[model samples]
Target: MTDSFLTISGFRKTFGSIVAVEDVSLNIPKGEFLTFLGPSGSGKSTTLYAVAGFDDPSAGDISIDGRSILATPPHKRNIGMVFQRYTLFPHLPVGENIAFPLRVRGHSAADIAKTVKAMLSLVRLEGFEDRLPAQLSGGQQQRVALARALAYDPPVLLMDEPLSALDKKLREEIQVEIRRIHQETGVTILYVTHDQEEALRLSDRIAVFNHGRIEQVGSGEDLYARPATRFVAGFIGDSNFLKVREVERRGSAASAILPDGTRIENIPAHAGNGHAATPELMVRPQSLKFVQGSGAGLAVKVKDVTFLGDTSSVLLETGWGQEIWLRGAGSAVKTNALSGPLHVEWNPADSHLFC
Candidate 1:
């Protein structure tokens, strides 16, 4: 933790009887892009605001460069921020807005001008320096706001759903820009967003928040492949949950009987409280494969199939009425024309078990 550039220890925020953030802790390495990702009111934003010094934690501390900054005010923390809305100054032209931060820090006018130009170039908005914010598109204004935040070269930049106001195409465009900017400057970034795609696109690691706590912190692949809890399994991707009866445990793996009475062995087991409660299976759509006979795996009746360009989604139902979805490449699935019961199979390692 001492090697981490930014450390948040036991951060908690309470509003009288309500707790917004509860015992959140994180360590962000220098130059690493870390994202706080979750749904609204899941404590992701509250934790970000605490780091930005907009709100104080009821208990705990935030530190930068191995030193505590809990006593520091927002302006003195030397952290830059972009919010859900563009906070650019409407009265100032783009050039002046980018120069404001440097000017406030008492940089010489010449240095401010130089920094502003470099920032504009970094964000690829060179010719629009003199244009008013109103004259620019939503994406353009956000780029200017980002330029202003980066003008002084803050050690950490915090972004909170900065592209939520833009259209889908524009949002994706700005996401690429943000990634490029991060790579260019190597500024340690603590980005906050509710979009999983955005987090997976930009973050070196993602901290998944839920119910005022971080359930897991890992790379996108880690969370999607091996989730720590039921909430995470459901949140990260398209997962089918099947209620299974726990048969036995062998070391870290467990044997469970599926709803269709097929026994699956060697599935990873993680019963959080050191005991299995009720066994459940979590499998991604793409993990299941179609097979020729019922002896290979569980049997399900094909209900529907939907084509989605590269992949097709196959909906299946167990005799007990449990629904399962599988994804196969378009060429692999000719089942849209073939009708009957089909067997679905998956490697035991491809599925996760939780209690």
Candidate 2:
């Protein structure tokens, strides 16, 4: 939330007749961990490439510390980048790999040696200095890549799915290291990933991209709890959207009736430009609760239930044949008792009416 340290203004990129990225603009503060999150071909990588000088923008400007970097070449930009694959020099040892950037910048041998030692220690690879890229594990190789990228003490670091090559456990382990390095080094990081959980765990703020445009930007909680668009609602977390009818809107508060004549009132609603699409009630799986009687809530027949460690996932079918999921404490409902008819209800305040 500080003054803008890295700015992208009206950035646009196109490939022949197709548009890769629209006019995307964002202001990033110094030392902020911002993530560009979206599915593949959603313009996240295109924006990151523009920042790293890998691709030229058809329009708009990219500035760092109040100076435009559009005219600067990639090497002169002094920016660091790590890609999906580990781009380590196979013939060189870890120490030399970490020292490559420092050498390129014309640092003294003594300075390079000192920085290499510190960088190795920062990545928790203290004694692996003499090991080659082939000798180290995938995660360790990435740590070395990270060390190499930071060797020149760049002002900003750009990561493009750097952990996608690692296994789940290794990926999670390296995520912790990345966070620690970010805190210790205080470098502004622009990370790109399609994994929502990764973005939620790592970013100080997330920019959700969709179809060559940025749909929303906010903290994980903000996007999950109050999404500005239906796409964001469906992307940020697990959501169950039930079709609703007879929507009456007055300001931000609205009421609607379900297909089974269950009335919900005084809920937050978004009537998008007075469109005629059927409004949907967006609710999280955890927000629903099972009641005993049919008169209390929407009547449903339990289709299936799966016990998942600390939680239970229940799949239910409504009278109109719409399937929805409900997740709750594993011990809340017995497996044997869930087969019959049940009623599911949630607080009206917990749902959003999205048109």
Candidate 3:
């Protein structure tokens, strides 16, 4: 059995009339990096708050290593937290800021010194110890906040879009730094972010939340390769959805009739995302091929073509009036050549059902 460092079962939270998180359950393996990914009002941050003890649950239990911590105060929970903004003291130096948590915990001066030194090394902020928050760069100050969070040696780390304020390049850099720190320390990390790329790039597992509930929980590959529902399929990545016009079942194999009178045989997408809302099947741009043969491919009229230097994206309108997006790499294909007639073909397995 995998050892769960944190297990949240049926955890719920409500703010007056609004339900922020409802009966969400998940098991986070020890030392594994888990991320809560969803858009705003989807309850990703609310779940993190429940785990951090900032908001007590309206129902259910939050256990760390098989013991309940629902009653534990925020300070007593021993969690490391990095918020969206760098919450460092403006008047204090970097060293003093990182030492604040240790000071609060009543550590000896010598012990604080040792822990601070180790944390600085871990976050690669060793030399910036003397610099004040205003003196250091944005990335450096962010690293100081991360170092401070780690100073207490908390087993679990909670990050709520810590790098959201930085530019893309700096954000990527700090993301790598955080990954390195996690690998080096083997601490259980619970990250929350609305950025899909960040979740895909950082987590051992990505739990997609929707409307105050967990929609799906699995590795990045699991989400992209096999999304549990249409919400997850549409939210986790870029996908083109086409509604299922009809479905024909035969034994274990099934077929779905598409909008263009095309049938996809022996595919699970025929039923859509199992018992949930019947949505259209998603056809990824990368999974499509421009073919010239007798197949069940949808015929389309190329409306526009964009040159992306290395790659090109084609926008088209199908005979069924559905817009199709295709991505490929070649001599930037002109829109004029593809304007008259175009067909999109792919393997049946590439279709992700939305029903």
Candidate 4:
């Protein structure tokens, strides 16, 4: 943490009576790929804007390499930004568009041409410099935008949902390109997006935001496996929540009674009070397995089955009418042949307790 290249400490932002971001802070190392991931209006974008010097924070400080930049104007921050919409100048050709940033920085014409060529090669669009923005496809235009952003060789790059405008296939393709560019350039990047898959695919560490606050920040596996809050567990991945009443507690973990009176133990009580009066069981579909007959678990009836090529998802309803889902290998569960009673069982350690 002492070697942090970018630091956001106690950041808070407000607009009139509305508080957009509050109490947000993070430490990013040099050449790190960190992502701000959350639903809309969760303050992710607001935090990024503050770092870019677009809006001054009501409280807290933002520093790059230990120097505060709160008073710096947006244009003087030397940060590159790529927004959701393509902001290319319509009249400028692809090559010139990438050269615009260099020209603004007063680089010599000879140096600008060299940088433009390198950027074009970096984005894998070497021969399209003569093409106009309108004449290029959406994916190609976004690539050019990326090339332009990197042309100036800014130490920090901020991306605000840059891939939101493209289709799924194109979006995925660009995600790969972004990763490659990050590796080749080694520039510290702060990317913003709401897509869980995209965040998991791209970030080395992710900060989850909600209602102007950061709920959690960690590696993809850490957040997915050991979430600190109920909201984080539900938001970062697919989860099925089952209502449960607290049966007992010991130390930091607790036990709870399921709907069918089956007891589950060793669940982490993240509330840290050693007690959760009203706790819900968070079980992933992949953790549940179909049992042949009723044992020490919840018995449910098959409601529906969906085959998704590599895996099949089975929807089950408890006797109390609560729905639960289980994912299995594609050939493991027959969608049409599924019939009769099926019980769902899981190891207590595989489940989480959230109150």
Candidate 5:
């Protein structure tokens, strides 16, 4: 892409028999907040370590601005890193913690002071410079760690589940702070996390990993709206699945018949060549709507409805034990209008037919 500045190509790592990363390739644009999002043991952290020079790749290369940096050591890589735990020195003051990187890089005392001051402001920890990291809140400590990383003015930054230690509200506040800082400084960032909402909220693009290989790499909308595989469809979020009893590949648009004899027309399924024939249909609960229609969609009985404030979820089932989920406003399902045999219609664009 035109925005690409840091390109990681064909990077792989193995621990004896187990592979941590396999042919991981992605272009991280300069000034973009890119996130490696996946579950635990999925190699997101390992990949971050590889890029930061903590873990060398068994194969492939990591390059910045089209030049390979695979041989560069962590301290010399000009990449700042903030770990999940605040790895700060106990004896050093918060200001000293931020200035240590600069001091080691041969910056004079005056330069270090100036740099540390600016860095402290960047993380909004200017006033607490004299205090120790242990004296601060979890959020404050994390901010100090961030300030320390950015103190040396590294061109690239790496973060590994940095806010996992904080509470949800604080984590969210720090997330927004991180996003704003990235925007203001235009530093290239490679953030690692397992939270889908965090990835969707803070990333320029998210690389989803599974079994050490990239399941799909795309914008949040791309991955969420148009997932590439069943793993992605089910993993990133919830989906109501139905077995494909019959397949009718009609040109670009294909239709699959569910076990309930309900025919759902899908918006052109891309050929899944290597996958086994585990026939299924995946659709977001929001796709299915309880509307007034006949001989269209599926006939389902509302088994339960859950209120989630913004959107209400309705769980339904077919006579033959197939399940369906519908999403709407919380107040919409109070009436008994949708409890009985109701028509559950989903747009062809919303459903994906997999065979």
Candidate 6:
């Protein structure tokens, strides 16, 4: 943490009566790809804007390499930004657009041209330098925007949904380019997006935001496999929450009875302070499996089955009329199997208890 390149400490932002962000702090090491991921109005952008010197925080400090930049102007902060829109100048050709930043910084013409060429090659737009922004496709324009942002050799790059405007296939393709650019330049990146899959694909670590605060921060695998809160568990992946009543508690291990009176033991318990919140068992769809007969499993009736390419989705209704989904191998469930009573079971270790 002492070597952290970007540090956000006790960050808080407010808009008169509305609090946009609340006491969020993070330490980002140099050259790491960190993402702010969450739904709309979650304060991820607010934090990023503060770092970019676009908005002054009501409280807290943001520092780069241990030096505070809060007193600096937006352009004087020496940071790069790529927004959702490809903000390339329409009249400028790709080469000139890329040279804009370096030109403004008073770099010599020779150095600007050399840097533009290298940047074009970095984004894989080697021969398109002569074309104007209006003549390029959406993906190509965005690539040019990226090249322009990196032209000045900024220490940090802030991307706010840079790929959100493209189609799915194009977005994925550009994601690969973005990753390569990050590696080639070694510039610290702080990306923002609501798409969880994109965050998982691009980030070294992700910060999940909700209601003006960070819910959790971890690797994609960590967030998916071992979520700290019910919000995080539900946000990062597909989950099924089943209502339950806690019957026993010993430290972090506890036992709970399902709605159908099936007692499950040794599950990880959280926030069990006997609050008004009801206890629920959180299980991933992939963790639930069909156990042969009615042998020590929850009784359910199959309602529907959907066959995806690599996996099949099976929907089942519990005896108490709660519906849940299970994902299995493509051939795991069949249409003919829907006629009889089905029982599903999961290991207690694979579940989390939340109240």
* Predicted model with the maximum lDDT: 2
Q: Total clashing residue pairs per candidate?
A: 0, 0, 5, 0, 0, 0
Q: What lDDT tens digits, residue by residue, belong to model 1 across residues 1-355?
A: 4378999999999989999998899988999999999999999999999999989999999999988988999999989998889789999999999998888889998898888899999999998899999999999999999999999899999999999999999999999999999999999999999999899999999999987889899999999988888777888989988889655788888888976679998999877421336778888999998888658888888888888999999888977899889998988988655478778889989888886
lDDT of 3: 0.84
| TM-scores of the models, in the order given | 0.96, 0.96, 0.94, 0.95, 0.95, 0.96
Name the runs in model 5 displaced over 4 angstroms.
Answer: 250-252, 272-276
Clashing pairs in 1: none
Error of 1 at 79 (Å): 0.5
State the displacement of the C-alpha of residue 260, model 1, in Å, after optimal TM-score superposition.
Answer: 2.6
| CA lDDT for candidate 2 | 0.91
Q: What is the alpha-carbon lDDT for the whole of candidate 6? A: 0.90
Error of 5 at 283 (Å): 0.9
Error at 194, model 4, angstroms: 0.7
Clashing pairs in 6: none
Local accuracy of candidate 4 as per-residue lDDT tens digits, 1-355: 5489999999999999999997999999999999999999999999999998988999999999999998899988989888889889999999999999888889999999899899999999989989999999888988899889888888899999999989999999999999999999999999999999999999999999988999999999989998888888888889998888555778768898877687888877666212345678888999888777557577889998988999999999987789989999999887766788877788877788876
For candidate 5, write residues 1-355 as lDDT tens digits. 7766888889999999889987799888788888899899998899999989988899998999989999888878989999998788879999999888887788998898898889888998778889987898989988898888888778899999999998999999999999999988888899999999999899998889887888888889988788887777777777887766888887767888777677766565755422657677788987777768677667788888787888888888876777777888788666467655777777888777665
For all candidates in order, the CA lDDT equals 0.89, 0.91, 0.84, 0.89, 0.84, 0.90
Can you tell me which runs of candidate 6 are displaced by over 4 Å? 272-276
Cα deviation at 308, candidate 3, in Å, is 1.4
Tell me the spans in candidate 2 whose CA falls farther than 4 Å from its real position: 271-276
